[model samples]
Target: MTDAILRMRGITKTFPGVNALADVDLTVRRGEIHAICGENGAGKSTLMKVLSGVYPHGSYEGEIHFGGEPCRFTGIHDSERHGIVIIHQELALCPQLSIAENIFLGNERAGRGGGADASGRARHGRGRGGLGRLLPGLRLVDWNRTNHEAARLLERVGLPENPVTPIADLGVGKQQLVEIAKALSKRVRLLILDEPTAALNDEDSAHLLDLVRGLRDEGITSLIISHKLNEVLAIADSVSILRDGRMIETLDPSAGTVTEDRIIAGMVGRDLEHRFPPHEPRIGEEVLRIEDWTVHSPARHDRAVVSGAALRLRRGEIVGLAGLMGAGRTELAMSVFGRSYGTGISGRLYKDGKPIEARSVREAIRHGIAYATEDRKRYGLNLIEDVKRNVSAAGLDRLARRGWVNGHEEYRVAEEYRTGLNVKAPSVLSETGKLSGGNQQKVVLAKWIFTDPDVLILDEPTRGIDVGAKYEIYSIINRLADEGKAILLISSELPELLGMCDRIYTMAAGRITAEVPRAEATQERLMSHMTKEQEQVG
Candidate 1:
């Protein structure tokens, strides 16, 4: 085997009150795909951040070796200069810019050659510099060269679209491709993808895996961090497991020895008997129903983002809404929850066979309905606040007396949820932003549950969390259903929907194409309807 391209020895990172990493070690070979798997709060992302210089050299105690040479990177730009690029879980793309502009955003062709106008040609001896040189000076950008190069990179990533297209018009999967293309433009030798397929659909994720393999064949090393054990076992040449910020073991799946169960055991320190908890559903009368619901795009009034969609949630029932990216499942949920999203919304919402007026967020809560947004970091939690404040944010009225919050009551309420949800935090005073993805999600759930809503709309509840955390969240959902709270689960993972939902609704192109019961629902059956495009009738 070739020598290690990247190595870290005796790495340790500490926060104010937490020792996030303790005596960690990792080694990655050249031109191989290495995957890091762990439970939430296991320090996977923190380790990567340290490597990529987001934490910098002095911030953490560690020794890093790249290409057999000790290196101390002071910042992300310094790491990028050495042919290392990182694509974070949350995409970092500017929605207002065109594809070509976004690709070459920071690294413009300003000082590079090729970007010259006609006026600059006559100024600095035009023919003196020959080809590849700009004609002296032109402050304006060369759109032609920029778009042409961007198109080549876009094609290389298998994205078929015009380079002039606005980023806002593209879906999440396409946005991910753009992120990869941007990384390629940086001439990256070692690419680090953190939860690359966390939000992708089945087809898009497969294509991405194929692309990663192709990159490996082309001699580019990759370090992927994912919660999906199957993908890690399938694509990684070596798998490294982390638990509570410590290195567990590294396994090579090509030896035909390691399995998903083994990896799960390593992550959680024990065997997991089942993925989903047992549930005895007692579905009763309908709690919430939407009829002929339609929502127009907030960006374009002429465009209808969701078209003629209808769904129902009965008491004590867990229903799944399955679809690919841009399928409008989120839009449907948001629009119904007090018209939080979309303009020109037309819908009829009935609770207990009677129409309810949910014209605003306050009214929506009053009507006993709650919606958890898919983008938790953005809309779900006040990241800067402590867990206690965030947990009680949704139901502040319950802890308020004469419009003033009662401190003791608030603390008691937050502590109850902190213990009940099994949130991994030192105390309720822990910052919401400082917690890991799974704990943050639990806090979001706590906030909504405090509202005591009879109907809950959970969108991508376990999108980026690890398997152990996912199981816990699933158990919580089952417990909620057992308590007669109606749940509408929106997920991109078909297996999750099939495993946890009593009935599944397949949506495509903003429409509910098919509805299948648990007895008949499968990934294949749901996917068939999910990818079915709306027929054009002239």
Candidate 2:
């Protein structure tokens, strides 16, 4: 028997005008946690999709060897049948279903001969035409048995005891644990996790990493794909780097040579002297100010998402709101921007020196405020629309003459922003959905920039984008600040906050707990504020 449990040789995949993967090779040892690191568009997800049968057999050129046997997977079900399961970057559970139901969705057991396996056999045995042959069949599903099995799987993945709980009630971290439990329920041998901790807080991320280590000890091999270098350094046994669809190199993490800087250099193909550009703080007059901003949740409960939050932004300054998930950073931004989210919002806004009221999104735009959402796909861009339409969506009123849009004017504006932002697409007529994640984010930025807002609220601006693209975004942000635009940047990455913002406000439990200037901000200090627990109200 071979030492390696999984191997891919000469893998190559292509899309229209793009080579997603080129002659890539990978080998996974038995019971080891291997990591794949790359920037966005670096072919990590594409390679995993091929392994998990999302690309299937004939679509890509590659040979997959599992347990020393050559295998061809036709679909995800084919891979799952052979104990090779992949958990995607996005969790794939039905929000309304219970944990037990989701875990045994396709693999259910029936009494005697009537469950999923039995139904298949019964259907095949119908041709035999014997009542006695099917007489012993039982079709009733036992809830007790299903719950027992699901509980075991959940325990293995370190989830709390709640098999009957709906997935929607859980946080992203716990929901990720449910995904791991679902994978383990299939008795998987080779498990793949793509950006497992991307949205998780530090404590939750550490717990998930510990679970991965435990899985390795129990003889389950793993392949992890992530951009966070620190987590890679902590959990990986060996690491592989990919650049522009080609395998750069694989290094042993234990060899004392695979530093975070080394891996970054390999991914980007250059030494980064400074991840953030230098800024000259010529912060001018106050551009935006909010006082006693409070927004209630849309749910029945009168929970305040943004509780008495107040802040100010100066022209030519980038201020960051640093917080863990659910800390109301995005909520505060959205609520202030034309009451787009939340209700019972009461806030006083001042533009320049005079007080103004923004009752709707259009009103907010009229007052020179623009908000770029974290979820660019859902809230920012119309995926079916072309680049020209998306860029001019915000300022369509200005582009119209006698209630009719001027196509020439629209195209001219889009062309100018596309060129300025360096958006890489075939043409402005290309569908927004067809672009890469990085470029899609750029289009969102372009749309908001077209609004010509005096104050811009960017929520997680670089989320899900690649390192190279993130650098471009960072540069763009600095240029905006240099051009005297006040930016409120909200991000989970401490380094990014420190690198770009002149001042950082640390939020915890829907309140700003601490404020730190750029010169005094450190990862340790910022994290201290982020994790500080709020006192329970009586």
Candidate 3:
């Protein structure tokens, strides 16, 4: 008999003015790593939310079967009772809490009493012996046991961090490991990870995939939603394609039928001939140059975050920065952009053979430089505002007359960008927060592009976006470069760097380690330079 751990039959989910999912069916075998691939807004995350009880039992029409028993989960806690845990793309850990505290935050173990008096149990909001069975001791948390268990879980996830470390102090990769460890603590049977490796680098992503493989070997089932096709192909036993809120097909990679091209065809509903737009940069004189740039840490005065980082970008040239996480690429970019990030920043920025003063964001914009921040939701856009406001946010002066915003001009600018970037929205009046990842990124680009900058810095431009959206963004980048705008691109994906950049610079330990021309750059060579500092330390 075929072993099936979970099944969803004829699932139909709908939201206002949108049918997100329609009569979709999915089955995951026991102890297997199943991958879900789709274009952005294809209902991947929505489906996972339904499976994990985020949408509740009666909200969506579907039959969800787990372990041969139909499940009607009313809430997340209900799903957790059945050993189903979901780690979302946006992490849910409290930054101020320590690792142990965050892991056992809601599910804490009790002390040595084993059971408590009726009055004691009532005081702690527990039924008859609820505290005794769940915690062993009533109203008393066991820190020793908590730390010991937390340490073990961390070790299993291959994270080298103390249990007492604050979540805010940890990097994005380590935070992801902690999320997995939290899931492990819950006796998870079917773990759902949505874009777990989206924020991670090559080494960290590799380690996470290894952990997933080990879990599969240990008979734990995983359902991963990812945009990185290579990772999905590498780790998943079976791959399911989703397009426009419908199931396309599921392929077994071991049967030699699964390829990136085939998957792209399924996702886009077309055989995409090329993953990237052909880059034929028309080289020109140097447009932007930085000399001996250095920035100190914001938290620590003595620590240097970026030191002696120097680079140059010419008109119509797209230059890429490749490095591991925490390699200071983002920091360098932010520091240069009006010192928006680090403290004690010392950098000499030259534009078109002349030194420019960009001590603040206003001056930076005035100097014809624009920065599309990495954390778009946090820094790039006002989520509560409409698309019209967000598009003119960076260049409000252009839409103002006599210290007053010209409403018609603002709408005109936003509509031009909205239509120009092909952002899928009802109108310029639509809320920016309501758009999907790909559309949101396009809006961010529209905001910066509206500023009419001569030089643009894009940080992780395609992060958390689907393949189709990535191709669109790449086309926009190529278009901008062709227009003689100097572009500085930073990306975690090596293939993206190799495909889009004319020259690639490698960063390690806050310094530029090597600069490779496009003709000589490869993944292996870039990675070698990226980890040189760690190798030297070892």
Tens digits of per-residue lDDT for model 1, 327-353: 899999999888999999987889999
lDDT of 2 by residue, 1-538 (tens): 1389999999999999889999999988899889999987889999999999999999999899998999999999999999999988878999888888788888874443222221122222222334325653535455666777888999888898578788888888999998889888888999999989887877899999999999999999999998888889999998999999999999999988788889989999998777776778779999998888888998944898877777889999999999888888988999889999998988799999799999899999999999999889888999999999999999999899899999999999999988899998878999999888889999999999999999999998998776778889998898888888999999988989988999998888888777788889999998988889553111
Order candidates by TM-score, high to low.
3, 2, 1
Candidate 1 deviation (Cα RMSD): 4.2
Candidate 2: residue pairs that collide:
40-466, 114-138
Q: Which residue pairs clash in candidate 3?
A: none
Taken over the whole model, the C-alpha lDDT of each candidate is 0.88, 0.87, 0.89
**Residues 152-188, candidate 3, lDDT per residue (tens digit)?**
9999999888888889999888899999999999999
Model 1, which residues run further than 4 Å from truth?
A: 112-147, 161-166, 533-538
Number of the predicted model whose lDDT against the real structure is largest: 3
For model 2, the local distance difference test gives 0.87
> Which candidate ranks first by TM-score, i.e. highest?
3
Q: Where is the poorest 10-residue window by lDDT in model 1?
A: 117-126
